[model samples]
Target: MSYVLNDPAAFADESTDGFVAAHRSLVRRVPGGVARTTAVPEGHVAVVIGGGSGHYPAFGGLVGAGLADAAVLGNVFASPSAQQIYTVAKAVATEAGVLLSYGNYAGDVLNFDQAEQRLIAEGIPTRTVRVTDDIYSASSDERQKRRGIAGDLAVFRAAAWAAEQGLDLDAVAAVAARANERTRSMGVAFSGCTLPGATEPLFTVPEGQMAVGMGIHGEPGIGVQPLPTAKQLGELFVEALLAELPDGVTSVDGARLAVILNGLGSVKAEELFVIYATVSTELERAGATIVDPEVGEYATSFEMAGVSLTLLWLDDELESAWTAPAYAPAYRKGAVATGDTELLTDDDAAAETETIAAAATPEAAEAGRTARDVIVAIRDMIDREADELGRLDSIAGDGDHGIGMKRGTVAAARAAEAAADAGAGAGTVLALAGDAWADKAGGTSGALWGLALRAAGDVIGDTEAPSAHTVAEAVEAARAGIQNFGKAVVGDKTLVDSLVPFSDGLTARANEGAALAVAWAGAADDATRAAAATADLLPRMGRARPHMEKSLGTPDPGAISLALAMHAAASVLNHTTAQKEES
Candidate 1:
């Protein structure tokens, strides 16, 4: 069901080949999985970087004309060997000497130290800069043992720029060491990632939950806990990071800091920005000035769904370099213009455009009069089956699907009634229903339903009257939008299992000249059947996939609910059409 590259062993080789090929002009591959800068200055200080492979742009991609002189790459979730370290050091060393900089993982420390001795024996000067910026990694007594996270970017970038500017080996190493001392990062994962070729995920978290302080290599986190809202999570990260800062430390010239919000893959940009908004507010309250901030997937683990926040206590020198001109496929430093202007006139402006209005035309009013009874009937059926749905989800999912569906539908029905009373258009009524579902439902399902409703409403915007065909087209468009945005397919064991079939059946019936109500009712039946049939299929995505075997034989709650809603819609359509014909 999930379409992923089959050969896991080939991941490292394939990825490295593509990476080097793309940046061949700026970087060169050294022996032992190490890459070096192609345009190293003759006597400039050398900067060496290294890390595990999956967190690209950290260790390898940063090697270039203005960045690291060399980078040693490791296998996925594994450390590079000592030989790999030595190979890179030898390739990039100069009389001015090489400064070895990398994360604080145990394997990295051992191998890098081994390579440091080897380079020294060869009469090539080398110094080590260990980065240990993860606040969750250890207590104050054992801070040196903490693993590095996004803070490595700031350390490496600052050190490399110093080296590029002709700082001596000791000076460059000192700058990097200072950056590590002042920086700290913390993260939480919504889900874990699968290693190449591994059918099972590396770790697991309970559904509808998250693991705080999870390591990059799928290491067990502090514990599984309720997933926080973006704002709440941001606050947690900021509080922890600030607690770790020294009492009197200020940015260079006594300013505050610059923040880096690094996505751990699969976390969307919108979510990251939401987190950033919360973080900025917290920083302001702490009397810290954030000179600049970065938000994006700068470091990742294949497709892990999480994010890490890195805070750097900046000096004027570091600030300049942090803002210096640099570019790579995955990392860049650029200015973003901001002004003291309000983008929205009011809080409602922040709501989706389709959410604010709810009015139906005369034709839609008639349609809703018929549809209202059907919706009530379906809602009653869902209320009756709530226990069964919960038990099924408990086998593999968070077991909240039933409750979420019940709440969403109840809210939607109330909104629909409100729309009808307001004499709103059909689309406006649907939009209101969607807003209700979104507001009531939590987690991914709520977001998906909200998006689907918003898309459908946009398509039917301001229509004075709508026929069955128009309603069908709008629903089809909404379904397409859900498919586009959610990237879900029929066998993903999502609502699509029911929705796809329901939409197809409805369209087929409509094409064959069936009345809208009759066609919709038939489609609803097909959806329910399809969803029941899929009980034998394993879920292939989201939190349910980790418990795939358990999920088997349990129909997806979202799918079942979707089918129920479609059937209800069909019944209402048929009643309205019949009434029209009689009149």
Candidate 2:
């Protein structure tokens, strides 16, 4: 468990603040995360790597000379929002373009791809290479679906080195992809990790047993077995990696490899050295030469009692990039030549904030106030149900959905209130609330909800008060946007499970000439029932897919949260109807 914190919810933010302060000479605070304090050569391809926080050196710590130009940090165990990634990229990107790299998780892929599209649309040449190197997550035929673990380090380093060598955007991206293909990793957990403010670990390993093939996001392993000795563990890692070489590697007998024995948080340096000794011995015995081997905490999962081993089978070009001199806060190799650093101005560090436009009509202003009230109610409802949602998520997924929802709704409520107070229209209020939710929460749920709200806002413009038919149209638009963005269908056991039924129900009721409040109530009930029904479905996507059996009897946290939000919105509608009747 993480022992120290100001507020559990604010732990990630606060820790980032401290890290920037401590490494001011190396990095500067950017809106989304951190950027290199020292300037890179102008028009050089900037390598931007990131993922969820809690995996320290992987992201922020890697921002410096010969490494990542910027890192877009998210809340613990959650991928950063698309807005966050865009902001970070814009800060560091030059005329040469940018290379974005991160682990191959569902949320990271979604957010990063969105950011990549936005950058290209804005005339910034941006490319991406998602690291997929965890051998245990998927078979060789399905390697693209594998989760990224410590192999993130190898890919990030290679891409950054390519950029440092004055390579163009395409070359940097290609190098990153090559590094990812050559890298292979496997991890084991003695016990699961616990998030801040959580009462217990996300999942627990039985005493004297080790969970094999666990993910850094607190996902349980594919199987469990008795804990092995350090030597035996080293043998297991070497054997697995040697058995399946990368496509070009004909044999491991004389292969040159870049090795990383990474400690996942609580594991000590001494223990790692002991394992590395055995690892080195085994590799040499197998006639493979290890070069520039790193043994320490490079990437971590808060305080997980686990470790991972990564082997990057190196070609001539790869060897040059892998062995280059580098300097980052947490990772350092040979001495890096120093030069005068550039200090960013206030405007460079500050992200652009949205401006509130005036309402088009007084009726629209009143509707904005109603929207604010609805968001506030939803926030309150989420606050009450957060723990239960977390419990359900922890059964098979990383237990952060509850906290992510809370953060998003709180930010949304505040933004909506501010917009309404500024005399903005309902459309503007919803759009602003969506931005706040996505920016503050930074995860899959946050991005989807933000997209849904913004899509609805686009349909319900500021020109007039929305009629029941217009409201139904807005709901349909929101549903369409979520399905398009997340690519999750009704039976995927995602929030779409509930959202689809709710949208269809509302559209049906409104088409029948029902009142807005009456239609919303029916839709809310449909959503609730649909969410409950998800307990019987197996997960087909995201982190939960690997442990689908464990989640058999539990409803998806995303589906349940969407249902709760709908019910809360329905309550607001009911109250407004009651007030109108009394008047």
Candidate 3:
């Protein structure tokens, strides 16, 4: 349980405020997350790393002299928006380029890759290295599918060190990839963690039982068994790593390893030492030389009462990089050379907020008003149903979907209103709203929604009002964008599940010469039915994949939320149609 003050939704932001206040000498506030207060030298490849907010010392805390130059943070247990990542990277970018790194979660992969492309388009070279090191998340052959846990440190540190040494983006990224490949982690949870203001934990293990192979996002473990003693637990950790040595390493005999016994959250230092004592002996018995064994909270789940162990097999280059001194807020090592410029004060580091609008026609501007109305309706409905949506998401995923939807929709509504007030067209308003939704919500759903909204907006050009045929085409475009960005086909149990049917229904109705409102209402009905049908689907992607069985009877929160938003939009269109007929 988190014993923090302030609203739960604002917890991350407020905590970040305090962190910047306390570490003004080392870190400064950036638009997305934190950046090193020290000036980055020209041509230095900026190493930007990030993920969700709950994993401290991991993201924000690791931004300093020897680690990430900047970190982008999202909502608890979610990935940061692409806009956020882009902003951070650009702010800290150098002539050499940028290297983005983070855990291998789907949301992170989607958002970070999107940012990398955006940065490259701006002529800033960018590369990415995803840490896929959790041995328990996937089979040995599917190493890329593994979730990154405590092993995030190994990748981040080596990459940042390489960047600090003035390596180019490609070389820095390769170093991080090698570290990620050599890393492996596994953990057990005796209990689960509760998000701020939540009464129940995200998961629960039966008393006297331990859940094995659990995720940092409060996901229940893949296996359960009676709790074992410290020595036994240590043995389990050692065996899991030894069983899956990286390619070219046939045996652990005489291999040098960088070991980390990381507390997920609440596990004490003493207990970790006790476990590490056994872990150390076990490693030596296997003829492995442990180099710089670290025992602390590196990447943590908020208040999760468990720990994970990471093993990074080190070659000569890796050994040098691993031993390099770092000066981050949390994971400091030997002293670093001090040539940083004057530290950025917290007040001086405030990011500028600005909005730019495109030209619009009077008719298109009128359409923008209706678009704003649709977003307001979405906000209202999501606010009303947030708890229910969150409850449903809790079945197999982090129970943040409802609140995430509320945040995104509210932000979207505000952005839409701003665009309309600035005399922007419908397409521009929708595009602004989509950007806001993704930036504020910061998750897989947010990213998909952003892509869908932007796709639709592009089809609905700002120069003119959209007709029924145009609207249908826009929906189809949105569907295509969702499919392309998410790589989720119909059976993936994602927003695609409902988006495809809605697009089909709209096209069918529009082709019959139906009005935009009429066609949209029918399409909304189809989407509603499709979303309901997903209750029987087993998720093949996102955080829900590991808990597929638990989600057997529940609709995907992403699909359900999209359907709800589309239904809300249809109602606005229907109301506008009725008003015209009355006039």
lDDT of 3 by residue, 1-583 (tens): 8887688888888988899888878888888888888767888899899999898887899888778888998888888999889888877887899989888888888899899999999899988888999888888888878888889899998998898788887899899999998898999999998887788898898999998988998788888999999999999999878988898687899899999999989899999999999999999999999999899999989988898999999999898888999888898899898863756544544555766565467888888888889889999999998988988888888788887888789899999999888888788888889989999888888898888788888889788888999988988998888888889999889888998999999999999999999899999999999999999999989888877898998998888988998888888998999998999
Sorted by TM-score (best first), the order is: 2, 3, 1
CA-lDDT, candidates in order? 0.71, 0.90, 0.87
Query: Candidates' TM-scores?
Result: 0.56, 0.98, 0.97
lDDT of 2 by residue, 1-583 (tens): 8889879989989999999889878888888899988666797998888889998887899888778999999998999999999999999889999899999888888789889999999999999999999999988999998989999999998998899889888988898899999999999999999998887999999999999999999999988999999999999988988888998889878999999999999999999999999999999998899999999998899899998999999998899989998899998889898866576732576778778997899999988888889899999999999999988998888888898899999999999999999998889989889888987887788888888888898888887888889989998999998888789998889999999999999999999999999999999999999999999999988888878888998999999999999999999989988998999
Leading candidate by lDDT: 2
State the weakest 10-residue window (summed lDDT) of model 3.
Answer: 340-349
| lDDT tens readout by residue for model 1, 465-494 | 555566578778878977775667999898
Write down the lDDT that model 3 would get: 0.87
Q: Which residue window of length 10 is worst by lDDT in model 1? A: 342-351
Error of 3 at 54 (Å): 0.9
Model 2 residue 181 lDDT?
96
Q: Choose 1 or 3, whichever is better by TM-score.
A: 3
> Which model scores highest in TM-score?
2
